[model samples]
Every structure is written in C-alpha cells, then in structure tokens.
Target: MRLHPDIPPGPLHEKWDNCRFSNTLVNPANRRKYEIIVVGTGLAGASAAASLAELGYNVKSFCIQDSPRRAHSIAAQGGINAAKNYQNDSDSVFRLFYDTIKGGDFRSREANVYRLAQISNAIIDHCAAQGVPFAREYGGTLANRSFGGAQVSRTFYARGQTGQQLLLGAYSSLMRQVAAGKVTIYSRREMMDVVVVDGQARGIIVRNLLTGELERYSANAVVLATGGYGNAFYLSTNAMASNVTAAWRAHKRGAGFANPCFVQIHPTCIPVHGDYQSKLTLMSESLRNDGRVWVPKKTNDL
Candidate 1:
C-alpha cells in the first residue's frame, strides 16, 4: 500500500490551520490508555515526551547518556531561528519558509517547511516561558542576531550556549513529568531493535550500557528521535557514541530511510588536530556574523 501525507487541500498559508481544525481529538479520559516510547532524549525527543505526558499519555523516554540533558543536542552552539521579526527586518513565516527552501536547494517538502516556519515564533515563546534566559537588549527585550542564510536578525539565543539553555528548558519539563509519574526516563539505555508485531512497531529492545543487559519494553507506539546517521561516516561532529544502530535496525524491520544522502557538513568545524582525533569540533555558525573565512597559502603560514 502507498502512503499519502494528510496534507490539507487548501492554499499553502491555510493548509496547517485547516488541518488542525479538521483533525480528530482524542478524549482526555482515554489518553491515559496509550503508552508511548520515545527513543533518544535530545531536543526533539525530550520535548515530545514531555508534551505527550502533559497531555495525559504514559510516556517512556530513553537516552544513551547518563542524564537526559547530556544528549548531543546540548553540544549545539548556534541559536534557533524564529520569525519573530523583532528587529523589524521584514522577516515573516513566508520569508523563513522561502529561505529554508532555497537553502535546502528546494529539496524539502513545502508543507513541512511551511509548518516549521509557522511554529517558529511559538517555539521561541515557549522556550522563553520556560526561563531559558535568552540574550536580551538593554530595553529588556529578547535579543536577535543574524545567522547564515538569513538577512534578518531573527535568531534567538542565550549567549553562546543556546542549545544548553533550550535543552535545560525541555529537560526541566521532562523531569516535571517524571516527578508527576506521567513519564518514565531510561537513561544509559541504547535502543538495539524496533520490535514489530503484525507489521506494526509495538515495542523496542534496548541494551543497558552500564550492566550490558538487554531489556524489552512494550508500548502502544514507538517514536525514534535517535538523531541522524552522521556517525556512519566514522568521523563527524556527532557524539562518540552516536551510531546508526537504532535507525539501521528500524530499517531492517521494514522502515524506509528518506534522503539518506542529505547529510549536512558544518563548514566551521575545527580542523583535524591530530591523527588520533575521533570527532570534529564545530564552531558556532553564528561566528560568520563577524568572523572572516580564509585559508593559508602555504603550509607554514599561520
């Protein structure tokens, strides 16, 4: 059977609004019956698990790190993009969408990109409400900065640790759900396989890194936020433990990989320092705002 995305039949601007209104809502009383297993605890996974638990679902969140906050997302140094137009730079949802599409060379789906742009402002507001401590101007308003591929000063940041602050916000929410007994967190557990029952993902098998023990977890649905397969290259900006194992196992269980070749390379990564170096360090993309890019004409030139 072929799959069709439930894209609403309307103008590009109205599709998301129309779809949200037309979608079916689950009764709050019945939400407790569903158990969702969210693999990985980065920004996407933690936020998802927290949000689902807040909506009354029983959520099991897993991460390979000793603490959920240590997920690779915390290593990101750049700020997040939002269409707040705080600088009155003519930035809008459409402009953000167009810029993203152009940056991706128009390979991204219009619906997905448009939806991301639409929610960009809400993301910033949500983060700020979580006390993310974003950089602000002397007037006490949130500060904005220009980032690569955008002319507007629309990137909201928290000094140079934007990802850390953002992850802390989500991590705080996740821990709140844990305290309320709405979410269960499995740290230092790496997903080994996706268990498919009757052609549907029903559970997962994970390995306890500390004890080398294998465990089975059954859930109504499994969400893989296990990040990318950049580690497949053997040398990348990904964490040391970042691997394709989870995604690879899912693919073996009949999940199709999309755009596997669309891996991104940060041009600002630190040059390899030695032959033994295992991972590349990334300089924040925001540095381009003032830093210049150049190369030495001779090997001995500093």
Candidate 2:
C-alpha cells in the first residue's frame, strides 16, 4: 500500500507556511467544471462545502438529517481553544501545539497538531465575524475561559451552546452557497457505499432514509465528515445518528485509518445511577470553571 502524509519540509513553525506556498492551486476558471461531494453537514462538512462552493466549485452536500442544523455537532458545549494571546497570557501557536501534544500523551503527529494550532486564530476570527455571539467581557473583548488541559484562559465560548452557535454560522454559509446555485443539498440521505473506479474514489451510493431508494452520485472528489462511532457500543453518549458506516465503507474502498482509538469524550457527565438508563446525558466539561467537583472519598462511600 502507498500513502502520502503530505508533510512539508521546514521547521515546525514554518511548515504550515511552506505547505500553503507549495500546494498546487485549482484555477477558479476551471473550478465550476469539477464536482465535489461533501457528506455529513456538521461543522467540518458544512464549512468545507461552503468554502469550496464559494471558490466556484459545483458541490453536492449530503446529510443524514432533514436539515443541516440537526447534525450532532449542535450537541457540543464548552468552547474552542485558540492561541490568540488576546488575554496577554503568553499564548502562542507553539505553546498550543505543545499542550495538544502533551494532552494526547505525545501520541499525536507533531505536524498535524502544529497546523491545527496555527489556524485556530483564523477560525475564531471567522466565527466571530459570522456573528457567533461568543461571550465577551464588560469592556467588549471576547471572553476567555480555562478548560481542562491548558494553563491559560484561551477558550472562546458562546455560553453553553458553543457548538450550536458555531454550527449555525457554518450552516448559514452553506445555505448562502445553496441559494447561489453553487451547492445542492440532499437531506435524509445516508451514504451506503463509496464508489471507486480505476482504484480511485469517484462517487458514492446513498440510501434515501424515507423512501428506501438508492441513489448514485458521481463526483470528482468525496469528503466524508461523518462523526464518531460511539453508537457502535450498546450504550453511548453519542448522537444516535452518529455511526461508523460511511467511514468504514470508505476504509474498505482504500481510505487510511489512523489512531482509531482516539475519540472525543467528556468525563464530566450526568452519571448513570442504574442499569435501566439506556444512555447518559453529557454535561459540559466547561462547568469546571465555576463549580467545584466533589466525588466520594472511597468506593465504599457510594
């Protein structure tokens, strides 16, 4: 098997810059002729579809829910971490990168983590400009909250509905693209199989959840932004619609899977007091900021 991780040659601080300068660009004149399929209209998928469509590409955006707003990303709380140094707390890209690596127990790729930190500031700025209504101080500066992993207060939040607000921003952009005729959204469709031609992923076959009809769509590229597989377990905190199917089908068609064990989870949740509960509800870890956590001193205390 052959794989290209696409790491650019440079110092860690310069690698993201190197990639931006070295990557090939798709001409705007020819973009309209290329069809790109983005599945799952969560924050990642919706943002990607909107951006690609804004670049003049013909995009087909698919989602399992009846509306993009219903995607599971809406369930997320807490806040987004960025090294903006807005709080004068000595925050920087390098610091965020190191913290992320350490938080992952040094198992994450340095390049990828560094890249994520580098772009975080831009994400926050874009989100704010999109009217996400993040909490701000009395002086009107964006408020910063401290989260579990980091030492500084760099998390930008929108009260307890950060994910919902962020998703709304992305969804608005996606709908703008749809109105411009650059993006076509297909709701209530579940991606069943990735269609590969000549050893290349060229399209997908999705099932209409309501009518049970199979529809085939061919595109120049396919993006699978399906969320986690927590549902794979009998009981989970994950959204019921979140499944491993789309990703697994793509994996069978030749996509690479890395760090399959790494997934997002919130430990501070409403506890399961009994076996009768089918699923437990997640309480935002951000609550740690203003509340004191109390637990039994020993197992016998319960």
Over 28-64, each residue of candidate 2 has an lDDT whose tens digit, in order, gives 8999999999999999999999999999999999999
Q: What TM-score does model 1 achieve against the real structure?
A: 0.95
The CA lDDT of each predicted structure is 0.90, 0.91
Candidate 2 stretches greater than 4 Å from native: 295-300
> Model 2 reaches what TM-score against the true structure?
0.95
Model 1 CA deviation exceeding 4 Å by range: 1-6, 295-302
TM-score of each: 0.95, 0.95
For residues 159-246, write the lDDT of model 1, one tens digit per residue.
Answer: 7799999999999999999999999999999888999999899999999999999999999999999887788896899887777788
Question: Each model's number of backbone clashes?
Answer: 0, 0
Poorest stretch of ten by lDDT in candidate 2: 286-295
Q: What would you estimate as the lDDT of candidate 2?
A: 0.91
> For residue 276, what is the lDDT in candidate 2?
85
